[model samples]
Target chain A: MAAAAAERERVPFTFSAAGLDHPHIHSMVQGLLDAGAQLMHIYDENPDQANALRAKFQTGQVVQELSAILHSEVDLVATSIVPSKRGALGVQVLEHDKHFLSAKAPFTTMAQLHAAEDAVRRSGKKWAVFYSERLAVEAALLADGIVQEGLIGELFQLTGSGPHRLQAETRPAWFFDPGKNGGILCDIGSHQIEQLLHYARCKDAKVLHSKVANYAHPQYGDWQDFGDATLVTDTGVSQYFRVDWFTPEGLRVWGDGRTVLHGTNGFVELRKYTDVARSAVGDHLYVVTDEEEIYFPAKGKVGIPYFRQLIDDCVLGTETAMSQEHTFRAAALAIQAQEQAISLTKAGERR
Target chain B: MAAAAAERERVPFTFSAAGLDHPHIHSMVQGLLDAGAQLMHIYDENPDQANALRAKFQTGQVVQELSAILHSEVDLVATSIVPSKRGALGVQVLEHDKHFLSAKAPFTTMAQLHAAEDAVRRSGKKWAVFYSERLAVEAALLADGIVQEGLIGELFQLTGSGPHRLQAETRPAWFFDPGKNGGILCDIGSHQIEQLLHYARCKDAKVLHSKVANYAHPQYGDWQDFGDATLVTDTGVSQYFRVDWFTPEGLRVWGDGRTVLHGTNGFVELRKYTDVARSAVGDHLYVVTDEEEIYFPAKGKVGIPYFRQLIDDCVLGTETAMSQEHTFRAAALAIQAQEQAISLTKAGERR
Candidate 1:
């Protein structure tokens, strides 16, 4: 009791839920709750969905309209809306002088991103996206710490894999449209892009070349099944990443997601999902430093620190957690890559 | 004694070494010598180089000019010349009614590839390039067998890494020129393209998109320090690969070259060089099948079977080793990727 009394208490921050569409909303909400945020309101067009999530968390009051939370003096808003609705919802959240935290692939088009940024500038509020590949994964958090501590020493390159389950049958109509999902580059590619920016510590990146294809799902005209892009960052770090929806059903996981970081001193590879044809286990990190070799099983052992830092950033009006420019630039690069992607089939065609 | 006598009595195919420049010439020549092919002549413009190579092999008579071997009765010519000179030499080898076996990046540009394809049509002699990632790596050969045995079901995708040492101080002037070395895509990328073709059983591939960069070497006008490409095969398999000259000196070996094949029933990953961040050991294979998990330490156990098969194909007119069309298609894709490459630093500028 004395130990608890002596410890500094975390200042509570109040926030609300916006769109509960993308499945990542659960994790996003869990992160906020875990970080000691007060959930005051829940807003969604569909009452059933909103009430279900509200009942599950049992912290926020269900509201029928989004404006209820927007007008309220909530510290911030948490959302995982469909890509098309994310931008407008973010603008509304910021216009009400509240911070915005949404699921990745934050905007489906450049125009929406521009308007959201404009609103953010006008309101001087925080704009953060849930790059769950890193934000949710404890392994990623551990890696960031290790990297920042100079364990690997001078990271030079990062290659990431983003093989995802399509779950095509259960997806909504907007999921099949290119303009809505923003193509594969802007959609799934955003995860790797965010990681590239963070690990490479680059403020800007140029999409050197990108390719997208609908080899299997031609039924959905422009919905891409596979996407790849290569880029060079302002810090001179090189990156290559491939995202695909062709993960075989028998593979036991959504993907064998891994990131291999090449550094000047040595290399580190994080097996985020399956350990590539080994066990079905995930969060295995292998490090070869100048002093020793370490293999760490990092699953469940680490917690999401980004959420806590972000919570503090929102409450304090500081950009220490992550700058707003990075959020916008990462999104911008993905969208630009999507816009400039070449077709994999005809070889010369563009979407 | 009976088996040894029979092997020694087998009809030996005679060949000449046309280019004594690239270090891969030693491996290419060793493969032939081990496969029971009799080296009849050594041909290079530099007589001293030809003589030195002949003295090392302790076989093959040193010839003054390349024309000496082209006019002789040699059944095949193994060449590993600069990328730009490879195609014209291939044309000469074909026109002379001799089979051609050369190192990868068989052509520097697509036009040369097209002309070589035309020559292959005009002359029925075999044309094979060494794809050593699979051809030399024991783990790859084992994976091929496993996949063929239905251990990992129908293949869907492949991810390959072709990291190589920069060896800047040891490199020649021509090695830094894209016109001579064919940039990173046509150079180290050839191994990946060939693996994609062989493992996917793909006859042809389209260069979907490609990026090349001179991130570290700004003075070398077209020398690429890194390159990546995404391609789709006619058989509906997708591939993404990254090749770079940024293997850190701390790395114990030349590269941690690896290939991961995703199949329907399971997945197989071959650690072709170092097992990466764990041990300096190479040729480690990990596989996850429906029935079991298997790990293979495949070094020194697997031999270069492609060489023996190629010798038979040359002496007896068989292509059990690999198809002529597959070779040309792999080379074509790499050359096409090189031709279509865009510089990552310059963004919109393309080769």
Candidate 2:
């Protein structure tokens, strides 16, 4: 471990997978460290991994151990364990379940999620989500690009959707329980909600309408599938979104997935489709003017690699990174939509 | 006049004007007829002008003489004219006002001016307005071009402003009476209101807010000199208009002077500034687009000459030249705004 740390430092960074418990997190940390990350503070609450690492490392030489990883002094923090539930009481536990199920999960509720967010805010640091990293990057890029490039003339509408499918083989049984914020709406819808608000450039948005349903993975015996929502802003722009657990074509992820913006001079449409089952993809963004249509391919490095970008942005003081405050708004919107969808379902049932 | 009518009749169409007792009504009728229109019917309580025409020609012609004027059969309907301090009452009177105003003063109100708009269903006729004869031609050309080109997009916002300055020496005293619907906000504002509603393509638009004030032209004595009004539609579009009796330049006899439209992709601004003070100089229109601006010389036409176009479209069973429903909607919006302005003024005074 000491020799590995020395070798990593020689190249400019050290990767100590001391705190992270997930294999993906460990691999990502190793890749960044190998590519020249100066320091990495991987953390998890599991003591067995910490003790195992201590046995393999020299005392006061490599892989420093900390009592609590998040509370420790670290230049950057990356976590994939955000709780999926977003409301009061049982929400935090449900979110934790979702985090375990989804590989890298977002903080469950806004309040608990605010710990890392507040840290970023107080320290003026940048952070990124690891699981839905492409979306995180897309949200940041589109928000900045629209304002910078004057694309889409004026954003009129934004829509997003996520997978409603949940695997029964996933060990976390609490993942399917709504009481623990285990529903697909709260888990995946949160990401979309955040992205929509971000792209719309809205300061404060209120949910205009929403709908949610449970369709697939009935064995989980919970409402974790088929959620759709829409919102309108004070500026007259509208946003719509949907998330389904039982999509037959595997996981499809898109940034600026399906967007239509009507401007004074013309319009723009951005459509992205990814077939996770085949690992195949197709995407296109077209801006239609009065006389012509301009198209651009959306191709980039995929996944939560944006986490590294967030870390780099924080360390380097770059203006391009997405802020926690920005993500929080999306989170809030998602939670609001989820609650609204449930209310709508109840109202519809009543009618 | 007979010779001219005979010469015109040799062709497929003819136009002629007959005198009426009241200058206002005569001016209105003659204006329509002189524009190459065939008068189908005439109904007036005052038969003096008709009698004088008959005696002058020794034709024994009267209001009933209109039957002879029409080569084909004509429809003649007569109703008693009642002078009420409260102005014309009932939906029929308002509906008539709309038709007459559109035909005689296309820049004025449409049939929807009646308070009973709720009872009238849209018949989908094109109702075009022209502040002056020159503008009428240009607008006619544009409408024809749009129709020929099928350049149809959703109309967004339309705005217009006509001169407020009325010639006191030539104007009747009743023209200044607000109770008789003679105020600038009603007369001129009505034209703008109609234009806006048509441009915005809104239906059943309720006035959300309005402000009206008389700020200039104190010298007009009994008549208010200036009127400024603003209205917001339920769909979120806003409109503002101002009318002044004194535009440092001389009185404008034709065209409301300026109009503008803002669409999704671009904007169109039309301005007609006549050397009204100079030797009966003709007015000209300037159209500005996002890419370029051009001026079109107005031949001596002053109103929407599209009555023929409307008639032709009706005969051909095609879409009307303009949207009558939109015209009525605009008029309704203007009236509602005017009422709101009055209410606001009262509220302000109480404060």
Model number with the top lDDT: 1
Error of 2 at B85 (Å): 31
| TM-score per candidate | 0.86, 0.41
Q: Per-residue lDDT of A165-192 in model 2, one digit per residue for the tens?
A: 2444643545556655534555667666
* Cα shift from native, residue B108, model 1 (Å): 3.2
**Docking model 1 quality class:** acceptable
After superposition on all CA atoms, what RMSD does each candidate show versus the true structure? Answer: 4.7, 16.1
* Per-residue lDDT over B5-63 for candidate 2, one digit per residue giving the tens place of the 0 to 100 score: 45445542322222232233343344445545454444343465555434443422355
Q: All models: lDDT?
A: 0.81, 0.42
lDDT of 1 by residue, B1-351 (tens): 334335546755788999877878889999989978889998888787788788889998988778889999888999988878989999999999999998988888888888888888999888899888888888898899988898777676788888788888988888987778888898899889999989888688877778776655666766887788878787767788988876766667788788988765667888888875566888899887766566788988877788888877765667878888888888888888888887664421222
- Model 2 docking tier (incorrect/acceptable/medium/high): incorrect
Which number leads on DockQ?
A: 1
